[model samples]
Target chain A: MKAVKVILVLFLLSILVIGQSYAGTIKIGAVLAVTGPASFLGAPEAKTLEMLVAEANSKGGIKGNKLELIVKDTGGNPEKAISFAKQLIEEDKVFAIVGPSTSGETMKIKNIAEEAKTILLSCAAAEVIVNPMAKYVFKTPQNDSFAVIKIFEQMKKMGISKVGVVSSNTGFGKAGKEQIEKLAKDHGITILLSEVYDKAASDLTAEVTKLKANNVQAVINWSIEPAQAIVLKNAKQIGLNVPMFQSHGFGNIGYVKAAGPAAEGVIFPAGRLLVAETLADNNPQKGVLLQYKKDYEAKFKEEVSTFGGHGYDAFIILKAAIEKAGADKEKVRDAIEGIKNLVGTAGIFNFSDKDHNGLDINAFEMLTVKDGKFIVLK
Target chain B: MNTQLFFQYFVAGVTYGAIYAIVAIGFNIIYNTTGIINFAQGEFVMLGAMTAVTLNNFIPLPVAIILAVIITIIIGALIEILFIRWLVSPSVLRMIIITIGLSIVIREVALHIWGDGIYALPYFTGTALKTLSVGGVFISPQILWVLGICSITVIILNLYFKYTLMGRKMRACASNRSAARLCGINAKNMVTLSFMLSAGIGAIAGCIVSPITYVQYDSGTPLAIKGFTVAIFGGLGNSMAAVVAGLILGILESFSIWLMPTAFKDVISISILLFILFVKPSGIFGNKEALNLKEF
Candidate 1:
């Protein structure tokens, strides 16, 4: 009985030592849509964050403190994101949080993160996530408005005045459509027609046919679903023959392969990651872009997408801030805001008190698919 | 509307209609034999397309498609044997819930196997950009293939039901299960055959339409809903009515975009479904007297 009592005391003493050691480590929480509909975005984001954290630990702990990553899979549900956010803040007491991969989820947890005074680096692309200027929240993806402006700038360069817009009824598509409509007049462009189609539509020929009938100078399709590829094919099939512009959501090369020959000459705005191989040696983002592309593709055995790059930017920004401020929550938050010209896979981020997204319209490079591969459009 | 624009809409409607009709026919084949609706019917289609896409990596496209259909048929039989056969006259609601659960399992399994990537089979004859222009109207060659193959499947199914011994026996089970068994026909085996038949046809439709409509892991659910709508619109168990109803729904959906936003396209079709169910529960082609005699 005395020996058993001694063993219990020893076990309890070891738990205290382990708990004390854990307090010295920095805990980073992530709420990602690791499964379900948004898994395409969150899966890559999760994998990238896991990869980067592993690499950081392997190269001696960051500032002599090991990192503990706690990823909560919200499965793209906003309610789940809220609960996960609270849990990460209160229970986990993480130093900072990253992701909630979709815009809706990010928006839902925005206030929770702010109220808790925890730093949040969002991976979603919606402009609203940063435009209202929450003190503690920052987003990594380039603004939807910026992507719209880049497309319109390309359209102006081509002297295309009137264009028809077709977007899927997804949040991404709706946000892009709203940006396109709101910015069209400013760009000296006339919107001939704007149509919203179902995201799961099996055939878009009728929608494309309407666009053809409108006799628009160009066509813009904003969507991230397989339906976008269908739009491309339908436009080609119905002989629309006009230049087609897509949103930054067209970053995945799988869409191009799915569209086959129809993908040729399709233009969209995206980060430099897709065309990193062609970027100039002196380009600020070229090295970061290439390294991430190489590392992610090598580790995951899949084509690197901009979605993953958004997660990469979020982690890199957080890491740089933590390194600079030594894990003090307020100092890390200020350091993140003060960050300037930080090269990332997405763009050279320059955060400030006023601008949280840290990306300009120039962050998007006009890219076009050619011969079933992405290339920078001249 | 201009003749060219009208024809374009017509062609688009027919292409979608063909696939919906095939899916509806798949529903009918099993519904006729077993009172229970197999919610996994759509998964059979997805499985066929996904299997063929994976198989095409190793073998020729034609061979891949054939093997995919056969494999899906076997899967259908196994599903019936494993899940449904032992149940002793299970309630329709219970059976439906079970099938729905089965569909979720299959979809989750598919998600794990395929990951979250969109895949499509190459066009049978030409590239995605290839189209045949007639006067001022354009039509994809794959659309022609879709229409042709779907029509052949329907006709072949009709002939099989009319001429084949197994088909007649299955029909006997459909009309009177106990009487069919008394006449030395194995009603349970007939039910299994019905599942195989439905899965085989669903697989064929999936392979033919996959080039036009890309297949993802969750693609089956939407197709299943649309197919269910078409099946009800035509009548529960009448395959011929499904063809006509499917085309009508497709054309209405395609043309609905002309008057309203394209987002309301599904709304238009589904409203029509509700209208039919409220007014004529027997469906457009279904005889009211015959429907009254049959148990739902």
Candidate 2:
């Protein structure tokens, strides 16, 4: 009994000491869709954050204080995201948070971040996250508006005036549709046909047939996953000769393989990370992009996607802020807003008081599938 | 509508209908023997497709397909014996809940094994078949494959139920379990056989449709729902009705995209199912006795 009592006391004392030491570290939390339907986005995001955080720690962390990263898997559920955000803020009391991979989940946690005054550097690309100018929230991925602008500009250059828009009924697809509808006319493009499809739809033949009948010069498919590949297959099978443009959601090479031969010549707007190796010698984003591409590919054994790049930017920007202003959440937020000309994997980020995403149309590169590989579109 | 566009929609409908028809047939085979809807019927299709895609990396396409179907049948039998058989006179509700549980387990296991990425099986021909245009309308060879397999499956099932003694015994078990057991038929074996048969059919459907849609861990639920709708709308246990109903549902969905917004495809599907239930509670060809008996 005496020995057991002494062991219990030693254990309690060690726990107290360890806990006190841990409190000295700067805590950053993350809510990512790591295991659900959107795992494709979240998995890479989680990996990038983990790797960057480890590297930061190895370099003696922020201001010689170890950075503690608390990552919660939201599983792409909005309720779970909200709860995770709340837990990160109220329980973990992290100085900052990063990611809630999808637009819908980010939206669910936006208010919580503002209320808690915690810096939320989200990985989602929805314009709504930063449009209303939440005091504490920002994002890393290029917005749907930028993608739409790039696509429209490409269309004009290609001398294509008429286009069909096919969007999935998901938040990402709907958000892209809204931007496309808003920007089409300004670019002198006609919206010949706009169709929405079930995200799980196995076929888009009927919709593509209608687009063909309408004589659209190009087709813009705004969605991800099995639907994206299925649409391409259906379009190819029906012999629809028009150029096919996809959303940045097509950044994953799995999509190109799934679409098979149909993927060839399909163009989409994506960040510079996709063709990092091919960037010009003096390009601002080239060095950071190549390093991240190399590190991520070497570690994960898969090609780096813009989704992962978003996570890398989040950590890179957060690291810079922490280094500048220490671990104070308010100071970190201000430091982030004041960041300028920070070349990242995504773009040359120029955050300001008014703009949160800090990426413009220049951040996007129009890429096309050639021989089942991504090539930079000229 | 122009004839070309009309034909395009027709082909789309037929191709989709072929998948739904196979799912419905799987439902019918299980329902006829067990008197319970196997919610995992869709997962069988998913497993079949996923297995074939995974195996194709090592084996020839035809051999991969055969292996996939056979593996699916073994899984089906195991599910019946390991899980469903242990129930002590399971209520229909219990059986349904059990199958739903089974589906969740299988889907999660698939997720761990395959990861979240969507996978596609190579086309049987190794490369895409060029569209064969009739006048202005176009059809891919894969669609033809889907149609051919569907027709062959329906014909085979029809022949089996009518001419085979084992098939009749299974139907006998479905209609009156105690009576069939009294007649010296092993009702339990019949149930296991039906599950294996249904799984084989479902696997075939998955393998064929995969080239068009691609398959992922989560693909099973939607396929299951669509198949369930087709089965119910066609009269639960009647295989012939299931095929016709599946085709109708597919065609209606195909045209609905042109007639209304694309988001309404799922809405139209559920709405039509609800409307059918309200108008014809026995389904289009539902046997009044069987339908009423299963209600409990």
Tell me each candidate's i-RMS in Å: 0.8, 1.3
DockQ of 2: 0.73
Q: Model 1: how far is B41 from its true place, Å?
A: 1.7
Model 1 DockQ (Cα-based): 0.87
lDDT of 2 by residue, A1-378 (tens): 999999999999999879856745988899999888898889899999999889888988878989888899998999999988998888878888999999999999899999888999999998899999998999998888889999999988999999999999888888899999998889999998899888888878888888888898999999986788888888878888889999998988888888878899999999888888777999888889888988988998987888888899999999888889986778989999999998887788999999999988898999999988888997
Which pairs in model 2 have colliding backbones?
Answer: none
Model 2 alpha-carbon miss at residue A101, Å:
0.7
Q: State the weakest 10-residue window (summed lDDT) of model 1 chain A.
A: A16-25
The residue-by-residue lDDT of candidate 1 on A229-294, one tens digit each, is 999999988888999999988888889889988888999999999999998899988888889989
Model 2: how far is A139 from its true place, Å?
A: 0.7
Candidate DockQ values, in order, are 0.87, 0.73
RMSD of each: 1.8, 2.1
True lDDT of residue A10, candidate 1: 100
Under CAPRI classification, how is model 1 graded? high
Candidate 2 runs further than 4 Å off: A1-18, A21-23
TM-score of each: 0.97, 0.96
